[model samples]
Structures are given as structure tokens and as C-alpha cells.
Target: MRVQGTPDELVTILRETVVSLVRRDGPDLSARQLGVFLTVYLGPGPHTVRGLAASLNVSKPAITRGLDRLGEFDLVQRKIDPADRRSVLAQRTKRGAALLREISAAMADAATPQENATAPTNSQLARSV
Candidate 1:
């Protein structure tokens, strides 16, 4: 993200990111779901179910279940793999990309000390965390 800061500053940034997400009513993604989603979006993908299972140290069915939730949110799409017809490929979606942008924006907002009354400061965010 090119976000430069010390460990404590980064901690403050992360804390603020959480508060910003909650304050802005962002999607509440489970760690597993977020993992799958981020892997698809951030990493090189044409990603297969088997690959995801291995990479995440999770079961194929668990990945499938997480994909179901992500698909419901329009965050991911499952397609029959062209090269390996037997496999399924997990692909990203526009909505998912938009959500990432939303998160990044919130994090950026968080980095700048909150001036508004509704948004919490880093200390308040730390307490919540």
C-alpha cells in the first residue's frame, strides 16, 4: 500500500482501519472469507479450488463454503476451469474490487487522524480492538 510508518504507527493505522470500517458500515467478512477473497483479488488468480485449499491450509469443502458466502455477496465467481475441465476456478468480480477500494479508502481515511465527531481516534480504536 506504500503506507510508511513505524510499528506503533502501523498499529495505530490498523486500529483506525477497523473503526473506520465499522463506522462506514463495511461488509463484515470472516477471516476465512477475507482470506479467500484477498487471495483471489490481490494474488495472481485463475485460482483453482485445490490450489486455494492447499494455500489456505484448509479443506476443499471449507473453501467451497467460503466461496458460497463470497459469491452471495457478489465478491467472487466460480467457473469451470477451461484447461482442466474437472476443476473449478475462483475468479474476482467488479463488486469485490469495489469493496477492496472501499476498504483502502477507509484505511487511508483512518491514517489521517479523524477530525469529525463521529469517527473515533486511534486511542479509542485501540480500546475497541
Candidate 2:
């Protein structure tokens, strides 16, 4: 079922997804790092530290710090722009794509209602009789 895009519902989903991520055996990304990761993966790439800083409304140093954390997870990589020696580009990795898929699954699970939790079972019915 599709989730209603209410603010409360959205916050619940975010909370659930974050909890799932934390419970799993994976890198725990900070808010800034996650933001950088999402932007690089979700948005059109060829992304640079300067461009990310501008798009994210953060400083270049902040973007670099975020990228440094992401790089440790192998979620993102930085390479010199071939045409421009002065520029460095953030590149996507296979691991990063897999992590994105995991996040999507977590969000999907968060959005879906746990019907079994609220549904009455035959055992409960017998007990009530």
C-alpha cells in the first residue's frame, strides 16, 4: 500500500528507516554525510565539492569532510577531473548502489503497515470465548 505523504507519516518513516539502519551491521552515516551521499547518488552526478557545497548550502570544507566519511565506507570516491586538474569529482560505487537499494527497502518496510500486529488471531478469539 502507498503511504499517505503526510508530515507525520513521513517523519515516522524516517524514524523507522533510521532505526533499521542503525540496527544493521553497516556504516552509520551522520546527517551531513547522508545528505552528501543522497545528493551524489540521487541527483545528476559529475558532482564536485564546490558544486555540492553550493547545492547543499554548506561550505566546501563541510562537503569534503562528508565525502571523506563516505569514502571510508566505499560508498563514494573522489577522483581528479580528467579535463580539469584543479577539479575533483565524486563518483558512485557498486557498494553505494547496494546501500541505496538497502535504504529503499528499509523505507518501503517503514511505510507498510504491520497488519499482523493489530489483527486478532484465532488463539485470541478462543481465549476471549
Candidate 3:
């Protein structure tokens, strides 16, 4: 079946498809939780809960709660800072890396057709470095 739509429509469809795929492959993660995970994972090395909360403009409690959830899923690990006993750092686990790979593959697959067909792909939405 041929799908006829504007570029915007296709972009939206591709975004939704990728989002759905990520959600399906990974444990049930809310948008907020996913955002938290990405922010922590992509942030500077050895991210502390307080640092993440500051970076995300959220409360420390919220960050802790989100980290707790990620911990429950075994996607993130919390370690007490050796230098500072009072500080805790959150790091992504192997499972989290694997999940990220799955999401990247799903997103790439969703964009492949339009990208190869000379149409702008969802990757275009990503800001160039």
C-alpha cells in the first residue's frame, strides 16, 4: 500500500514508530523516565543525582525517584562516590547500553526508506554537531 502524505506527516509517523519500538523493546518507561535516562547517560562522566537534577531543572527527589525506577529495571546502577561518601553517582548498565542500541536500530530502520528515497529523514531533525 502506497502512503501519501506530506513530509511533516511522514516525520511524525516515523517518530511515533520509533518511539513505539523503543518502548516495546525496553521496559515500560514513561517519557519523563526516558528523558531522565538519556540525560544521565549522555551527561558528563560520573553523574551525581544532584548534578542530574540540576541539569534537568528538576528536584533532587524527582531525580532520585527516577533513578530508583531505573535501578528497579536494572538499567542503571548507583555507586557511592569513593572520594565523597555523601555523594552517589548513577551510571548506565550493560542492559541500558543494549537497550540504547535497540532503540538506535529501530530509529534507523524507521528512517531508512525515506532517507534512501531522497526524502528528508527523521535524522534531519537531529541538530548537526
The 10 consecutive residues of candidate 2 with the worst lDDT sum are 117-126
RMSD of each: 3.8, 7.7, 8.5
The CA lDDT of each predicted structure is 0.83, 0.91, 0.78
Candidate 3 residue-wise lDDT, 13-97, digit = tens: 6676656665684587766777788887777778898888888888999999999999999989999999899999899899988
Which model scores highest in TM-score? 2
Model 3 gets an lDDT of 0.78
- Residue-level lDDT of model 2, residues 18-112, one tens digit each, is 99999999999999999999999999979999999999999999999999999999999999999899999999999999999999999999889
Off by over 4 Å in 2: 1-3, 116-129
Candidate 3 lowest-lDDT run of ten: 112-121
Give the RMSD in angstroms, all C-alphas superposed, for model 2: 7.7
Comparing 1 with 3 on TM-score, the higher-scoring candidate is 1
- Tens-digit lDDT track of model 1 for 1-129: 576876666876776777666676556778799889988898887789889999899999999999999999899999999898999999989999998898788778767755553645466677998
**Could you tell me how far off, in angstroms, the CA of residue 40 lies in candidate 3 after the best superposition?**
2.3
In candidate 1, which residue pairs get closer than 3 Å at backbone N, Cα or C atoms, i.e. clash? none
Off-target runs (Cα >4 Å) in candidate 1 are 1-3, 113-129
